[model samples]
Target: MLPSNTLPNPAILARPRRRRSPMTLGAAFGLVLALVGGGAWLATRTPIVNLGNEQQLSDSGLLQAWKDGAVIVMIRHAERCDAAPGPCLAEPDGITVAGSQAAQRVGQGLHELGLNGADLLSSPKLRTRQTAHFILGQALASADWLGTCDPQFPAEAMAHKRPGHNLVLVTHNGCIDHFARQQHVPGGERASGYASALFVSLDGSGKARILGRLNEPDWQRVLASSGR
Candidate 1:
């Protein structure tokens, strides 16, 4: 048998590891803090939408509303350069080629939804006008109110709703955000990306209620659902 003093004790081998040094612990904590800080920064940079408690309309519902002339669709213009916002009317750096194609697809989707005799209006900006033309296969009326991010613009547009005709406005992200805030749209809603549509329903009293937002992918889903 081995001598007790010479042999290593099994209990000693089974002992828990020693606690790390304070400097090492602090470095680890700081790394965690850095990672958490990065995540928060990313969240702040990301755009978020709040749909609130409003009922979201399905694809069929939206199509029916369009047919009933009770739908008001507000869509942001397709992709543009990352340059500073300026008068797109006078500027040449408008929508990218991919943006144009995306607008065409959106237009096709609208046609599939039976966009018959709908009144389409676009911001005076070149990108918006281009999107409207691509979608409708014709020039659209230019609306100065849609060219800016004025919060009152949506309400003003809704006030002039024409019976038996759905209205479509192609504008900017700022304008859409302004309208959403004015309508008290709830949070947890996904932000509309480029070429996305925000569908609203107009009542007999000319009051407009938000239905929900449909992004490019959502449109595809709707199309697929209908086997289109």
Candidate 2:
């Protein structure tokens, strides 16, 4: 006969092990994703202006947005055929035929975008004035307030514009880029032309912020990538 061996308690054998909860792990992962996605949305989302086609900046769209408040659009002088960065030799105007054509394109685009009410301003330089004329369809008086190259000009025109006015400034690439740096917008390092529009937003707090940049090449892409 075998000796009776004490068997391990049945209660101990039946006791359940303390395993990790799969639901808890899933919840933690979901929380992480939510936080990451929210941050990405905020990082990419900016107040920069929309540079999309007519459908985007229509009268009922971006233009109206400015009309409700102050909207400033700054552009570098149009494309110049001059091999070197100097005044044009053939004409007193620094702008060439190509540049003139580009200016016309800008005018047409502005008209389509319903910015006819835009208060156009320009640099005193010949090229800048000529570009402005093409868009405004008339020789406009140079604004000492708008010329960036001129040392006497105001430090910042956007801050100086009176209440209830929309300003579109035609100036050199350098000045536009400088303002872009002050506002912290991208792509100011490269020379651009024509339908490029850099839009900034200044809240009631009196701080000018880089809202958005709309270039001719990827105007729509900027909008789409922004997820707005």
Candidate 3:
């Protein structure tokens, strides 16, 4: 007696209701747990570096390792001409020919790390400028951080410059000494045999951690790690 338009379609009525299987729900939950566990494990793993050795870090190699985000690199000006230590010889006349060559090595190391053209900063000392020019291949702006020649400057100014640009500094032993003492690192007994480079990386939470220390580090590994 009902009209065809008023009645439900036979095809719609004939279709069976389907329920989700319990197995499917279990599989999804397992997958979620596995992913979460894997992520947490990854977070706890230490960051790696490929320093073949301490004394062979090349400038080109290190450049490749340099990365974006906030990082600070400190280098003792390659080998200098100054033989004596005092205020009289404290003028900033940078590295000798051999020292410049060493700077080039550091520059090459920087390039290898991944910084094509990095933000160069330096102390007011001429040697620091020369070191920056040789290693970074550019004139760097002098910063109070560099002038302080204190390794703990970054620690002091964490709020202002902790998590910004990737920076490099060319300075003397005093900065290294202060940094080593504050960081609990032994730079060297005397200044003569104490050439080294220190790389510091800042995390998202603004905590700085030591990434590498090379009495003479391998630049290649440093560059590759930064890219990663």
Index of the highest-TM-score prediction: 1
Candidate 2 has what TM-score? Answer: 0.59
Pick the lDDT winner.
1
CA error at residue 118 for candidate 1, angstroms: 0.8
The superposed Cα distance between candidate 3 and the true structure at residue 105, in angstroms, equals 0.9
Pairwise lDDT winner, candidates 2 and 3:
2
Candidates, ranked, lDDT:
1, 2, 3
Better of 2 and 3 by TM-score: 2
Clashing pairs in 1: 50-186, 50-187, 51-186, 52-186
Worst 10 residues of 1 by lDDT: 46-55
Candidate 3, residues 74-143: lDDT per residue as tens digits?
7776666574343322344555666666677777776655564545667777777777788777887877
Deviation in Å, model 1, residue 114 alpha carbon = 1.5
Question: Candidates ranked by TM-score, best first?
Answer: 1, 2, 3
**1 versus 2: better TM-score goes to:** 1
Model 3 stretches astray by more than 4 angstroms? 1-68, 84-92, 150-152, 156-164, 186-195, 215-217, 220-228
Q: Report every candidate's CA lDDT.
A: 0.73, 0.60, 0.60
Q: What stretches of model 2 exceed 4 Å from their correct place?
A: 1-64, 84-93, 150-155, 186-191, 216-228
TM-score of every candidate: 0.67, 0.59, 0.57
Candidate 1 accuracy as lDDT: 0.73
